[model samples]
Target: MRINVLQHTPNEGPGMIEDWANAHGHPMVTYHPYQFGHLPNADETDMLVILGGPMSPNDAQPWIKQERTLIQTLRSRAVPMFGACFGAQQISKTLGYEVTKAPAKEVGWAPVYRQSTVIPGIPAELTVLHWHEEMFEVPTAAQLLFASERVTNQGFVLDHRIVGLQFHLEPRANNVREMVVNDYPYIQGSQLNQTAADILTMPVLAANQRALFHILDYITADN
Candidate 1:
């Protein structure tokens, strides 16, 4: 399967999603829209994976709009899609929902509560890394699947083919380090934010990788 990843920044790549694809013998390609300002043809893409970014989905940048257009086209074709953080907001915004500033910025390891058992393998509560200040509202017709104490809209599953998450489950230690180093200034002051040391030193949780693989498998499953 051809898994196309729409990446917004250099620091935020596919990470373990690439690992999953490799393990499953699927080819994964990543597009840096922010830099190249180009996207792949929807007809050529089998599955769409949108990675997180520092920019808001509501931005007026041409690349952002182009990305949204691609998402719409893919959704129309019923292609499986998985989004993370800013990518989640993009999906929600394209679905006519709002992406607004969260009640509070969740910038570190946090726990999300599962609201529905529609997607199995994810525990009732799982601690995942977070670095987003904006949150997406659950789209109409989409099932709200996860939530956290501070963020009511942590995740949602739509049509059993698309999944959007507000947190980081695919980032490995190196990915986390890159993000933390590149955006160090953004992690200051918030009580929800974790220090660089804690974020980097935190042991990698096997559960996060398992949950991420489950999500990818569920979304891309042939139904």
Candidate 2:
């Protein structure tokens, strides 16, 4: 399978996704738009992964505009796309939902309550990583996949293919440490009160990777 990753920053590259693809010997293409100033041709890959970044979807920037346009185009074709954190926020916004600040930052390990009315491929329960100060409203045409008190719209599925997950399912401890030091300034006084040490080795961390695998297997399978 050819999986394309849209990486907005150097530090926030694909973590477990890279490991899984390498282990499975699947072809991979990474679109570092922030550095390259352009995204790859959507027709080149079988899957699309919109990774997380610090910037909001509403940011007024040229690359942001390009990404939004690309996502919209992919959605029009019903491409099997999976979005994480800011990518989820962008998907929500592109699909007519609102993305805004939540009551809390919701950093670290958190239990995501998988809805009984979940997509056919997702697990019944998932303990994913959290590291966002914003959340998005569910698109009207999508089914709610998961929820949490901290962020009601934890996950959503559209057309039984596209998915948007606000929490991090592939969050690695090393990446968490990098985010703590690099993204500390943004969350320092925001609603999400957390530090790198608080969740580096939390038990829930293991489930995050499992959840990502389950999700990937589900989405990549023949429909």
Residue pairs with colliding backbones in model 2 are: 105-191, 105-192
lDDT of 1 by residue, 33-148 (tens): 89888999888899999999889987899989888889999898889999999999999999989999998888888788999898878898888898888899999899998899
Error of 1 at 165 (Å): 0.3
Please list the Cα RMSD from the true structure of every candidate, rounded to 1 decimal place.
1.0, 2.2
The clash tally of candidate 1 reads: 0
lDDT, model 2, position 151: 72
lDDT of 1 at 135: 94
Judge candidate 1 against the unseen true structure and give its global Cα lDDT, from 0 to 1: 0.90
Error of 2 at 30 (Å): 1.4
For model 2, give the 10-residue run with minimal summed lDDT: 186-195
TM-score of every candidate: 0.97, 0.89
What is the lDDT for 213 in model 1? 93
Which residues of candidate 1, in runs, are more than 4 Å off?
A: none
